[model samples]
Target: MKRESRQTTGGQAWVVNRKKEDKKMEPKWLTERRQKAAEDFKTLPLPKTDEFWRRTNLSRIPFDQFEPIQSVTNGAAKGSASRYLPVPMMVSGELLYGEKMSPATLDPNSQKAGVILDGLQNALEKYPELVLKYFGKGFQNRHEKFLAQNEAFWQTGVFCYIPKNTQVELPILLASHFSGGNQSAAPRLLIVLDKGAKTTIVHYASSETENDSIFLNNVVEIYIEEEAHLTYIDSQALSDQTFEIAQKRIELETNAKLKWVLDIQGSKLSKTNIETVLKGSGAAAEVLGLLCGNKKQHLELYAWTQHAAPHTTADILIKGTANDAAKTIFQGMIRIEKAAQGTESYMANNNLVLSEKAHADSIPRLEIEADDVRASHGATIGQVDAEQLFYLETRGLNREEAEHLIVEGFYEDIFGRIPVESVREVMRKNIEKKVGVIA
Candidate 1:
């Protein structure tokens, strides 16, 4: 494992930790970038007065309560030989690699397949041109305050580059965790697939400690070249005490294809943004998300797609359930530029309100500047079907059992679409526990 870092007189780096014997000095350009980002973070304050903050309350953040990690922290369970374990598998395609403890523990098979996978710092030292070219493409620091803060403080990230026309047989896993020692985290990921390359990645995230009141900020960017295909699945079950703010965006070239799935079943409060830009003709994208929130947990999700070239296509669907006093929000938008003739796009959000006090909000918007395009958006919010429950109870099941079957049937289609069985089982178990159906 190659390690690269910058040490201060305080005897540590503010971002990721490294051993004394394996330290690789930081490059001049990277050091300068880090310094500038830190300065930007200090100058840019959190957005408290913005119109975006109107729906959700941001006043509860404890800015001064937690501190950064001083040493290496790994939450791998005891007796496990590998530092990492498989968490989210179904939607994640071939090759499972995790950033459990150190960034160097890449899959040997993937390395042999000409897949370049390593920590962001290590990759920065080895591939400066590629890293710098796509670090922050469509989104700029000035576009969002939290994004700027993340750019400044981000110490740990992954860089994955797949050579042209190469296929790995196993699923690759990308994982991150917020341990007890590290209450606040900022991590980013950059993925680049050369022309004709095809790969699938399963993104899994969790908390090291069982439960801790912490904050997390994460960002990911993917660049797909012409004729390439990328399948990415974001599945995380973090502790309920954590506040998660994450964004993921993608850019696709001519003939490129992308499949994205998100399963958010944990966290006390979270706000997520996922966007895609079809920059080439014949490029296509698919997005799916499933989430469950209970008690006082709150979740807000955003998705946007832009058709910048003729013949581009995008499809999006999201389903969620809110129980107890929990709440959920989903907002989706589609944009067809004037030059993007023959573009096709559609979006929908469906939510299940299990409790009278729970609330679900859905907003779908579209901006069309193209004369030849097909686009539409829709949303629905309702309670469990009383007829279904009555039919189930009339048979052999009890009230709880009947409700459980109804809810299970509702998510059956989405769960069935996941490719892995073990992951599907785990997700089913979690949904049961969260919604009090399969206890």
Candidate 2:
């Protein structure tokens, strides 16, 4: 049987078609999430020079030159399994939704604590109420056309739920592979933590295709309920030839805690929107971002913290290095509402420019409607510290070695925050590759 070619510009149809299939294949309670999101996607116009995107560069986005990911019926499954064998997972298979497969099952061990960890399709069939209750509950509605496109077309996704009072020490990993013959990839994630539950999730987005895969767009939604604890680690290594658009939203309830990490290393042009909302008193949220751009890559990251409850605390730290004419932009904002008394939040961003041709910008903003809140913001853009390099060189290090050592130290603060040993080690290895450092 011949497979239908997917259109990049009309990617919305891919999601809409999937929605239809899902409606027939999924439970009735869960259909509302995709339906409402599709409608919201249709109404929300793409952002252009808007307040939120003032410092962003969208001229290089090749929106029309991309298409949805093609079906993996042609040995792609076996190829991926063989490639990722060393990686730990209950199932290294592709993520599927709707009536096509049994909603991509998870390991039975995850179910031992009343947790439901499966793809979106399965959540619809078995835990529709949970998925609908938390989807888009904290994400922003204002964004560019790509965001709407994501809402309209996000069919294949990872879904996880931690039941009340349960604790999951092992982290759950969700990796999205976009290695189509000639197509775009649209993926989504929905995570929920029941009252007093605790869990951690790791999301990895990458392209296995060695060829020119035009584009990949993804959206992820997370909910941390009352007294729940959630730690999320997100990493991206898209093909250097591809374009990427991604959004991540997290909500926190009373006394809930969230630790988030964002890391990026590949892709020609990429934009990320990460945000957290404190909805209950005494809630806490922390965001850490690390980016390395080389070879003319253009990247942008925007992080936001919204404190809507009293005594909430949030902090953000973003660090990155750009080399070989690469460019990076970081814009973050923190808002303390009038009702958010005694709120405290801080935002800091730093960048290391390894080459004169490389460029980076940092914009941090704060809004405090409550006079009793404490907020602070800091930004630094500069080259490596010559004194630090000189000191390292005095210890018998070569010029390249001295420079690499200083840069690595500069990023150690963020590196220290990656909770998982394996992910942290991978982060260090990727850093070494980016800076071409040995050992």
Which of the numbered candidates is closest to the native, going by highest lDDT?
A: 2
> How much does each candidate deviate from the true structure in C-alpha RMSD?
6.4, 5.0
Worst 10 residues of 2 by lDDT: 1-10
For each candidate in the order shown, give its overall lDDT on alpha carbons.
Answer: 0.71, 0.72
Clashing pairs counted in every model: 10, 7
User: Model 2 clash pairs?
Assistant: 8-66, 8-67, 46-144, 46-145, 47-144, 67-184, 69-184
lDDT of 1 by residue, 1-439 (tens): 1111111111123333322312436666655655565555555556657644445565455544455442232334322212233433332122222223454434565567678776676678788888888887757655465676566556567788888887754556666666554366667788988888888776667765554576777788899999999877677777788778888889999999988878887788888888899999999998888878889888888887999999999988888888889899988889899989999998888898877898998888899999999998899998977787789888878877776677677777777667656556666776776765643
Candidate 2 per-residue lDDT over residues 302-328, each given as its tens digit = 898899999999988999888889999
Which runs in model 1 stand beyond 4 Å of their true positions?
1-24, 49-51, 70-100, 103-109, 208-211, 398-400, 437-439
- As a whole number from 0 to 100, the lDDT of residue 160 in candidate 2 is 77
